[model samples]
Target: MTTSTLILPGSPEWLRYFSASKVAALPIKLDERGEYTRGVSRWESPFSLFHRMAGHLEPEDPKDEFTVGHAAELMLAALYRELHPGWRLSPGEVQYVRTDLGVPAMATLDRRASRGSSRRVVEFKTARDANEFGVDGTDEIPADYFIQQTWQMGVTGYTRHPAHLMLGMSFFARRLFEVAFDAEVFAFLLEAARKFNAMLAEGIEPELDDTKPTYETIRELHPDIDGTAVYIEAADAQALLDSEADLDAAKSFAMGRKSWALKQMGNAQYLYVRDPGGDHKKDVKVADRRKNSHGSVSFYVNKKADLAAITGGIS
Candidate 1:
């Protein structure tokens, strides 16, 4: 019997398998449940996979209806089903699939959709605006989300998986993008999972990355600092000191540039960029200076600024 047939989805046996969504972000020496299990087996869900991969000591807390993003997901899924004809959307029951390296994995899709013989794995997401989802002008999705969907497609055995994104808090704006399963990416992920499991078996910790989750994990690992002194290699001590000096120099340089920009924008509330097209001239606001009631001034650049359109003269 195959691994999938051996362990039924959602069963106690299934809980021992690694989740496809968490495979990419699963930290070294950490169990599937975000707890240290050493040589024991554990399980993980898609909801907290991103945090787990980042070496966070704790998984993400459950979200409720009060969370805007979670609420938008529910609204978008329902509205999409109502608007589209012949499309049946149902909760994706847990699915089990094994990686090429023989790593048992499972996934629970956001929505399993079907139209006659055509089937798809649907994922719903919400952002403050279209820009966040790259629906405004670009074609980029977050790397973590892309990996999660790819893993889901592998488990569901679907060729097409589409993302349903809702922009803002309302259901007025929405966009859909079709994604295809990538065998090469899946193979790479499988190898990564194999390596992680190997490290877990040996109880080896992975090196830390420059992420907040990793930093927080380091802090949690040493909560109470005793007055005992530990000796470090001379080379390691020099490297740490050099890194601190570089960081301080970079900060000073950034402050100098900020001061120069503020001096150039003296007395001007807004900085405008003029783009000339044929006989027409279009003016776009690139940056603005605002003064609050507390008498403190702040400067900000327009995050939605069109860089291509503003490549002309600035005034």
Candidate 2:
């Protein structure tokens, strides 16, 4: 379909219900007929499909930077045309490809490349820093992009995947990684999607990650009730108590170290520690950086920046 035919999500209001991306994220376990499918986006977590099945799905916010990524892609496409004269980058539709489990999957190419019948998938990305794309020239695509681009290729039946990333917020630094589609990874994602979907259909909630956001999401879903109590395994209860005790002990030890450091500093606001074996080496500095109104002491490690000098490489 042409870009003109495509109705951007949240544009006309009614398109939200039938958004291809949204349909692809439905609980896989419930799709017995295997109709709904979607290509994974770059920013989405690998377990996003499973998350959808677990009833934790949230609408993609239009304000998200990924939403701006499309505009960036358009600009990049124009620049790429100037750099590579013969290549054509345009949108192409790939109808749903059936996975081994009979599920229909689809991929919306960011931009399809065609030069004399040779087609390639061009993935455009904007990263916060170069590190997100990994050390330059290593050809290492980050795991999230790997999962996303590979799925796009699998759906499009393309073997060549050319990913171009604009590194950093400045958008000046650039990195291009030529990633090959991996059959093993494609098979794994397909199977994983099916398995997670099945689990969700069976009324099983996905295991929560140890992150504050996940905790907050759960809390929002099920807030405190009026004198409600839930039962847990005795071992689980004991584990929580043990963790609490360990945390308290760790906190006490840390506080003790701070107290000792403060005593050693006395009138000075900083503490310097030297290596016992050598006097020539630089000392480690613990600086009293800032203070709050509550009279809390904040310590900061002052280290010299010598990455290039130390490694004989550019910083």
lDDT by residue for model 2 over 56-159, one digit each (tens)? 55544677687677677766666656756888877543233333443445455567777887777776677643434555545576655666666666666667
Worst 10 residues of 1 by lDDT: 38-47
Any idea what lDDT model 2 has?
0.55
TM-scores for candidates 1 onward, in order: 0.64, 0.58
Q: Output the number of the lDDT-best candidate.
A: 1
lDDT (tens digit, per residue) of candidate 1 on 182-224: 8887676666666665655565666544444456656665789
Candidate 1, residue 56: how far the Cα is off, in Å = 10
Pairs with steric clashes in candidate 1: 25-53
For every candidate, C-alpha RMSD to the true structure in Å: 8.3, 9.7
TM-score of 2: 0.58
Worst 10 residues of 2 by lDDT: 11-20
Give the distance in Å from residue 296's predicted Cα in candidate 1 to where it truly belongs. 10
Clashes of each: 1, 2
